[model samples]
Target chain A: AQTIHQWPVAEIKAVGSPLSLGCTIKGKSSPNLYWYWQATGGTLQQLFYSITVGQVESVVQLNLSASRPKDDQFILSTEKLLLSHSGFYLCAWSTREVFFGKGTRLTVV
Target chain B: GDKVKQSPSALSLQEGTNSALRCNFSIAATTVQWFLQNPRGSLMNLFYLVPGTKENGRLKSAFDSKESYSTLHIRDAQLEDSGTYFCAAEASSGSWQLIFGSGTQLTVMP
Candidate 1:
């Protein structure tokens, strides 16, 4: 069985603070990875996606970025956090069926 | 223009009844997929669709490539079926980026 893990399940950071959220996928190799952000009571929005190591594409520019440093690791980061960036962050991977992680709740105050 | 459009943004259905959700695509899609996001915030894979129809238990789905549309039918609705349903599609000629619908919030009433 495959599983995805996300860290810092819930976070509250001050405005303009640096942010980093991590994700790891187990039991899969070279799978397509994706990052999504859902605003409070808003629809799910695609943030970024990576096809392989060291490759990522931005789907929605929200002053955020993603990095695929390894086959099973994905990181979403930003240098300056904005109030609008607060939301639920989800990391997903697809081999044949798309699988999602538990998600991280970010609150910027 | 939105490549993927979902209907009935929200629905309230009585238990033991049946209802259907739809997704219309403006781009040429090669494959379609459905997902369920439960209240607990876990997104579960429902179906990975091909151009035709498929049935699993009380759920069924259909995708038409030429017409660029897909529909999800839920039968024998139960309280556990209440959640937000989403449909996504991958374009045949464009980037592998899968586009998702705004989602349909379904609530089952007793």
Candidate 2:
């Protein structure tokens, strides 16, 4: 069975601070990775997707970027965080069907 | 315009009753997937359909590409079924990019 793990289940950071969120998929090799963001009480928006290592595609410009440093690892980061950046961050992996992680709840103060 | 529109933004169901959720797509969707987001914000896949019907336990779903719509049927609804149900579709061929609906929040009452 494959499992997806996301780091720092929740975070509270000050605005303008750097942020880095990580996700890793175990038991699956070369799977497609994606990052989705959901604002409070809003529908989800796709931020980025990576089909292979070292190549990432941006879906919507949300002042964030994603990188697939390894085949099973995908990272979401930004140089500075904004007040509007606070929301739920989800990491998903797909082969035939898509699967999402528990997600990280971000609170920017 | 909303590419994917879900009906009945909210619903209240009585236990043991049956209900159906629907999604209409304005985009050219090739596949559809249904998901349930629990109160804790964790999304669980309920169904993946390719212009056909699928049944699992008391839940059944059907997708019609020709009609550009999909429906999810829940039979013998339980309290645990209370959640925000979302239907997503792949807008393009083999894009793998899922466009989600606004969702239907279902509250099952005893």
Candidate 3:
């Protein structure tokens, strides 16, 4: 079975602080990785997606960037956090069917 | 305007009853996925469809790509079924990203 893990289950940061979130997938190789953000009581929005290591595509311009440093690892980070950046961030992998991780809850102060 | 729109925005059902959720897409969606977002903020993928119908336990989902619509039917609703249901569509003309609907908040009473 495949499993997805996200780090720092929750975080509270101040505006202008740098932020980094990580995700790792096990039991699956060369899977498509994606980042999605969902606000409280709102719909999800695709942030970024990577088909392979070293190549990530931006789906929305939220002033955030993602990188696939390794086949099983994906990183989402920003130089500075924004108030609007506070939300639930989910990491997912897919090969036809998509599965999501536990996700990270970010609160910007 | 919303690309993917879900109807009834909210619903309340009694235990052992059945209910259905619907999604309408304005884009040319090639695939549809149904998810249940729990109160704790985790999205559980329920179904992924490609212009067809699929059933898993008490849940059944159908996607009609030609009509750009999808439906999710829940049978014997239970307390644990209380959550927000979301439907996402992958458009044929865009990147392989899912455009999600606003979601339907469901409350299954015991």
Q: Give the TM-score of candidate 2.
A: 0.98
Candidate 1 chain B lowest-lDDT run of ten: B90-99
Q: Weakest 10 consecutive residues, lDDT, candidate 3 chain A?
A: A94-103
**lDDT digits (tens) for residues B15-106 of candidate 1:** 99999999999988888999999876788889998799999999999999988899999999999999999999887633647788999999
Cα miss at B51, model 3 (Å)? 0.9
* Chain A of model 1 scored by TM-score: 0.98
In the predicted model 1, the residue pairs found to clash are none
Tens-place lDDT digits, model 1, residues A1-109: 8889999899999999999999999999899999989886667788998989999999989999899999999999999999999999999998656678999999999
The residue ranges of model 2 lying beyond 4 angstroms of the native Cα positions read none
Please identify model 1 stretches exceeding 4 Å from their true place: none
Which ten-residue region of model 1 chain A has the weakest summed lDDT?
A91-100
Error of 1 at A47 (Å): 1.4
Candidate achieving the largest DockQ: 3
Q: What's the distance in Å from true for residue B105, model 1?
A: 0.8
True contacts kept of each: 0.50, 0.54, 0.77
RMSD of each: 1.3, 0.7, 1.1
Q: What's the lDDT for candidate 2?
A: 0.94
